[model samples]
Target chain A: MHRLILLLALFGYLPAFTQYKPLDASTINRIKEGVAEAARTTNTISSDFTQEKEMTILKDRILTSGKFFFKKEQQLRWEYTHPFSYTIVIRDDEITIRDEGEVRSFNTQANRVFAEVNRIIIGSVRGTLLDDTGFKASYTQSNGNYIVRLTPLLVTLQESLQEIVIYFSKADFTVDKLELFEPAGDFTRITFSTKKLNQPLSNEIFSLY
Target chain B: MRSFLFTSIGLLLLLSGCQSIPPRHLTPVSHHLPSDTFLPTAHCTLPTFFSPPTFQRALFKASMDIREHHLTGLLFIKMIPQLRSSRCDNDTVSLPAYRIVCSNELGMTYFDLEVAPGVFRLNYCFEPLNKNALWRILETDFRLLLSPEAGTTPIKTFVQEESNYLVCKSKQGGISRWDLYSPMGDTLLEVRGKSSLADPSWISYAEYHREFPFRINISNPLIKLKLSLSLLSLN
Candidate 1:
């Protein structure tokens, strides 16, 4: 269940509808190379994000807004400011979460679920998840973005999550939106805006203490 | 053979009756009026802790401690006003419907449920919480918390002289419940009842601000389950 929590964390606002077509093998290779190149050049990222969760049973959407930060390799911070305040930061092998002003920390190495979820989060942001063998990847191209649909091949993940769709900007190959769909017809969407790339971030921002 | 069968059935009933809910101790007041004593007494008005109109929606930081597992999440409740069928001459009749959804901090939903008077529908439930036993417990808790005025059963009111608290007792679907109210009759302090699962349970509400309780605690000692909710916001 905890693993399902972070897998569900890769959520954001939905993007405008657009026609998408499958990319050819050659085009897919070029797009992958471009995304890899962008990931290599990007050292840091800070952005404001809005997440909306919608379900068939619910009449209104659950809306939340937050700030996102990431440093190269494995430093990440997700802070929710609206509705309620919650913060999760991952540095190296340590994962820290501050909820209701109470701090809890866990070692990723000690928890395989956390380690896998952390890897997926960072990999999704860096466009490195396209190479993850755990999921079957498919590519689609819209007028404004290249969308990668990852269907989890792992049995445990398949029980809760149907698929994950990430939308990358065609120009810079940066992530613009993310969506996670569950087996119960519920979906979470998140959109990133006002993103600053390669910004200098101090280490203290990742500490919850 | 028929006589033997009847004897066995009588013995089973006697044995099962031994495990029924323990009767609550109430100091009898001579002048108290039970609801059944009044005319046209199909339903009685009981003091409720929550006002439906003012409390259309609420969001809470909820935690559940059951046995060795502790889960934390955000609990969102929305009150949807349901209208009676147009077939009825009075179309103005409205019923309170509650939609409850609980999700982790990361926004993963654990359960989605709709509860109304004499109505319960489970729209969605996380695989881990998709147990019949758990559902029975949750259903009873929500029904008692949200809509105690289903009006299906007659309620009897008593004045407890020792505590100076008005106690209301009702039996519905074979489960007996007792609600204790403050002296003013505007606030509900605690609820003690037997759950549908035959587990004795108790719930208490406290720290009211703006006519809403900021803290709620539920306990089922037989099952070793405890749930606590703190108000996060009024959504």
Candidate 2:
């Protein structure tokens, strides 16, 4: 959905003018290396996710749950199972979206925001967020999870997105939860569970006519 | 010279005569109440739609089709009351009413407005939708949709037409709304227009909620646009 992707872009943060405190160099290096190692073994991943969109004005959160899939070399599928029927699949630089029996396909280059969101989603899944120099990152640990807080540096991005907070399960270094906070204080939280790693996935699963 | 001046004025008047109100039309209209059942009430009861209950708030899953642009999102509508300088004619001072806010699921605000006796304030609107023409259209639609004064003040007229439909037309401030009701006195349709004009870019309401018809569809044929809304929750 363009809306969902736009929401993702609306939540994106790049390192520019931010108040985020940088972690020590040693701590940052360790996290970058650890995430890289863990992602290398994750050839494919399939997980169930629950997304909660909290709107502060109405003081309510809308809930939607779906299935997510990611494969190496830029392939992803996100499908919602309830409230409404919608599906989005990204293979390489192409994006295919199906809504109410209408299937539309377009290249990621068509929309800058969409492309950025695609990059961030794929990067998050593959633990490659450390590769993006646009965001200032801070690392912290609590309980059994490692947390990373990303803040945008540019004024324009800072106006749109406040922060991107990600939580990693210390056991396997896998992402457990992702939160996108907007400048208006509204936020979206996505929690992943029942993840399967390195399992073979057919290319047909990303097919959409 | 005098003759030439008179001719210019005559031409201007002729050109102005060609201008007229926008067209109004409807379908599935073969059913309506008979004209003989026409009646009048001291004050209109149909205006309660404009004045919602105390702390009125509702959530809706909304889909809007504006030309080629299609948008689907959750809509939140809240009515907050305010104490105000009353606008009253004669000895009866009008009571203040609530302000209405419309926003999407992500808290992106659409517009904030209020309509009460001698009060109409449009506080905010999304920039892209704030164009003079578009905003005029939206303002007219909301005014027609939410103005209680439209159905209260003027000389009220009611007529039942073919198809067992009772039509009530209320006029105030040159604005008029024809509220079509079923035989059971339930509102089925509301069409707004200029009081003196047959068709003034009319907007219509349909597909009311089952119980009180809270969920409804609004369509403007002139713009070829439709907005569908379904109640999700109430607070």
Candidate 3:
């Protein structure tokens, strides 16, 4: 009787141990496959975006509305229409800013601060951030949506960026929102609307003034 | 040619007479001094209030044309003494990314560039003014230089050397010469300078035309920027 009771206790504890086990190898492989699929599906993206910057130090926030275009292989353009007319274009690691006939060009590799910002922006549009080797990502399912939380592994990147949370629709895997939190108590939240994916975006669109 | 020579000789003698007056000794009088009565004594005592006396809380609209850049825009300026006291409330439709502030006291303005993340300050001179070491020359006999009422004794009188020149001498040992001609001489708007004696001296002179608004120019040799101002409206 004593031996039977010990056997029953051991058998009951096995299920709990299996329940607490870490995500299996197959589960890890599935996340990688999903990320790769998302990247392949997005070739070109064009959208009308509204950028709102809220400075933690000031009471008033600045709002800017513009049209953004991105093509695979690193071509991007942002044109602001209201409150001012300004254009910024990125082509082959060069950023061009044209404001009221004053044009300035800066090479990405020359400015380290700007280069980091550009990398994040380009990676987001290309869906390459999902596979960013500098960060570790985990997906959580909540409210019928998939939330990907990315934590930087490198010290410098971690100093500037605490984490980046991306929300996507689970059914179609379409990105809807992104939140980037800086270590210095500042954060930028961007929500996308009127998004057109896999559109026929021309290379000339990025080059036009 | 013979008649012209006679006239020239006679004019030279008259000018010499004007400059030869003997200096007179009179007690320095401050009652009629513009420096004594014009600006409030409290303002001068409290050095921090060193801003323009007029248009402290007024609204102004003007058109700015930058000749170098060939850029023209309509600018609206609102000055409020309370709340946003330090900055000029400006709204420009053309350059939507920035706000501009024009100082009435300092006679300077700055552009707050928001979108591009920068700031640019532009200096304007409305009248010729000096604010550094040069202002000392004006205060040596401030009571006499700026007095609206000329004293009783005309210690010296100026007679025209020619149709275009006059010389005058004061009892306190000051001399002035005036040249009158439309083509040969351009009437300058104002002269400004800083006092040689004061620690931080700024002086301004404004020349007003009978029909049009006045011109003001400011020079600060110590500072690199010079300013010019055109009166858009008197009110």
Give the poorly placed runs of model 1, Cα more than 4 Å off. A1-18, A92-94, A107-117, B1-25, B28-55, B80-96, B117-119, B160-162, B196-198, B233-235
Q: 1 or 3, which is superior by lDDT? A: 1
- Model 3's CAPRI class is incorrect
Off by over 4 Å in 2: A1-22, A105-113, A153-159, B1-44, B47-51, B54-56, B81-133, B143-155, B160-164, B171-176, B193-209, B212-215, B220-225
Worst 10 residues of 1 chain B by lDDT: B38-47
- Leading candidate by DockQ: 1
TM-scores of chain B alone in all candidate structures, in the order given: 0.77, 0.66, 0.25
Winner on DockQ (2 vs 3): 2
Look at candidate 3 and tell me the lDDT of residue A84. 46
* CAPRI class of candidate 2: incorrect
- The alpha-carbon RMSD values of the candidates against the true structure, listed in the order shown, are 9.0, 9.9, 19.6
Tens-place lDDT digits, model 3, residues B115-193: 1112122222112232322223223212221221123235322223233221223322222212111211233222222
TM-score, cand. 3 vs. native: 0.44
Ranking by lDDT: 1, 2, 3
Q: Quote the positional error of residue B170 for candidate 1 in Å.
A: 1.8
What are the per-residue Cα lDDT tens digits for candidate 1 across A25-70?
Answer: 9988987898898899998999999988876555566788899999
Specify the poorest-scoring 10-residue window by lDDT in model 2 chain A: A13-22
Error of 3 at A62 (Å): 2.7
lDDT of 2: 0.63
